[model samples]
Target: MLDSFSFFNIIEQFIIGYFLTINTVYLALVVGALIYVRKQMLHPSVVKADALFKTELFKSISILVPAYNEADNIVESVESLLKLEYPEYHIIVVNDGSTDDTLQRLIEHFNLTETDIYFEEQIEHEQIRTIYRSPDTAMLTVIDKKNGGKADALNAGINIADTDLVCSIDADSILEQNVLKKLIQTFIEHKNTIAAGGVVRVINGCEIENREIDKIHVPKNFWARLQSAEYIRAFLFGRVGWDYFKSLLIVSGAFGIFDRQAVIKVGGYLTNTVGEDIELIVRLHSYHLRNNEDYQIRFLPEPICWTEVPTDYKSLRNQRNRWHRGLADSLWRHKYMLFNPSYKHIGMFVMPFFLIFELLGPIVNILSYIYLIVVISLPTYFNLTFILLFLAVSIIYGMVLSLIAILAEEIVFKTYDDFKDIAILSLFSFLENLGYRQIHAWWQFKGLIDFFKGKKSWGKMVRKGFKE
Candidate 1:
């Protein structure tokens, strides 16, 4: 019964509604951070490292790494942390009852000797068998504890962190040497800043020597290349924009720095949620606004952490599913924040955008595609009408974001040099919209289903190893 104009109108409405509802806030954030970046482009923190090493100005931080049977990269990960350029910090590695030789590897590498370190049992966690410290290297402390999830492991680390700040990194990820310095500067420069998240880059194809990224190269595997494109789109466009509006909802646990007291005040990390990083940030903002306290959480455009992307499809799917479930769980658990005026920016903008575009985005997208195909099958149909329109809209938006991310890198970090990489990246960005985007949508959709079914297992990642 619907006419062509009416049918097109429905599609138009969906597109316009999406733009006005989510993209506006996103654009606002992009513009805001761009302006901030342009303004502070010349600031010394943008380049220099020694300035960030001042003990009086820099905040003391404790780095927490929770390992679960990660014998492959445990020692290298710790060694990378030990070599960071920060002035004052402590490393706390939680051995979460690994069946592998994870404990022995650390002991042999770090020459760890057991110590009678007493920690206040502030947060409940599985019992710790022993705590060891490298007597020769004053900054290292390792906790041999029973198997608890990442959240519980982090909580144990938080209890023993005798510092003003805490930074959490994934067990297998490698951080840029200057990551802590840049993150800590934010806390020092901005008095109200509670947490700071840094950009994470793909290291799968990059030449990495001594646990640090030495060169940038696109992965030979298609999935890894797609992920590299995804990361560029995500960090540069998504996060930068979110932070600009002061409505950032999630800080990636890959490399995030937080105020110790603020995290502790909110009762540390939640053991129940897979997306504990996001939940804690949301709760922190909720408490701040509810109690009328001023605070800020920000992200830096600089690449602060380099992590391996899954080369094969299976591992990538698991990672995406876990991430999607995290989004769903965090959103559903904090559903009260949606449109609640008290939480202000987070309640009004961040929560709603996440629910609509991120949490339910998979279903909506899949349904829309299905509806388009059905419409095409009609006898007197407009072939290529929806197809062309969708391509025009998606490509324009996608390319713009990629370009911005590239621009951000060009202006700030300039990590990649080869002009050919830019062309390859550009092609990858377009290719991502064709099929990879839909695949991710399906992964997220599956995650939503698993979440409803009460799935809580941290899906394991099978690695081919990041050898470039």
Candidate 2:
């Protein structure tokens, strides 16, 4: 019906519109995050650590660490958790049938002994082999159970945690000394707060001293460097922006604090889904909104959790693939919330945004890439203007978003002190959009395929442990 150029012109317009639309939303999110962070910083509720100890807002919490064959970092991670500045909180480690000497290491290191502590099993989970507690530490508890997934392990930890709030973290992650103080402040300030997530920075390039991150710098490994930028953009703008609208959907599983009873009411994390973090959060929203209960799920920009990110190609691919599949799985599991006015902004705007922009984003991106290649191969359609416009909208704009995220991190927390590391991050921010982004899109597309094909495996994740 139309000539080659004319047909391509329509496609080009659609592509540019899509890019501009998404990027513009991204830009708005950054702006919104900036405003929200500034407001939170100046808010009167910002309490000092010592002052916070005496306040009525102090709530006892349980730190739940689900470890599976995390022998290399288990000791170090637990030692760091002991150093956290929370006034009163217990550490509950669930060793989910780790073949490695993960449980043995804890027993030897912390003098863990079998305890006959009883707890109500509010949620369904596999049978526990034993429960161990350390008399010396008086705060650490370990649960040995059959090999269920992370969700099942967390549910086991939840049953034993009698505290009002529970903090879920990866076994390899090192929390900032006062992270609990910062995260708990949310619940203290707002009684209606149901759950909240903190920022998780890459720990690859950091220097570890006595199981604590002594210094922070951009990751040295190539893959880790790119992911570092990706993490910055994701936390600073993506989650923060969503928080501004009170429509935040995801509170990263790596580091999030939740109300204990609320989680139990929602039946804890779903054992079947690899995306238990998002699934639980989405369910929380659905449960609260449908029941006409006023609640808030927040994303806090302060409290930092330095975590180990995948450093190699295979590991990184596996991680992203699982993440995309998780997104798809979460969205599908709660499809009832899509475009339903009964759920308010969460159903109307948040769900649709995730569906079109996040869930199917990779598909749209890959299709555009294919169209570009086909057009460029045909000599008759070799128009420089068209190619430039596409690159400008797609590639260059992404780089800008990354740079803004880095600068925003600097402006907010000044996490990276070395200017050279900042420069390196900036370089990778530009470089990632060139080839890496397209490849990432392909990986996510494959994940979508895997979801439909009913792939349930978490794939092998090999960690090189934290660098010195």
On lDDT, the candidate that comes out on top is 2
For all candidates in order, the CA lDDT equals 0.80, 0.90
Q: Give the least accurate 10-residue stretch of model 2, judged by summed lDDT.
A: 43-52
Model 1, 163-251: lDDT tens digits are 99999998879988877776677788788999989888887777878776778877767888888888876886678777776778778
Q: For candidate 1, give the lDDT.
A: 0.80
> What does candidate 2's lDDT look like per residue over 399-464, in tens digits?
898898888788777888889999999999898898899999999999999999999889888888
Per-candidate RMSD vs. true structure?
2.3, 1.4
How far is 109's C-alpha from truth in model 1 (Å)? 1.1
Q: List pairs with backbone clashes in candidate 1.
A: none
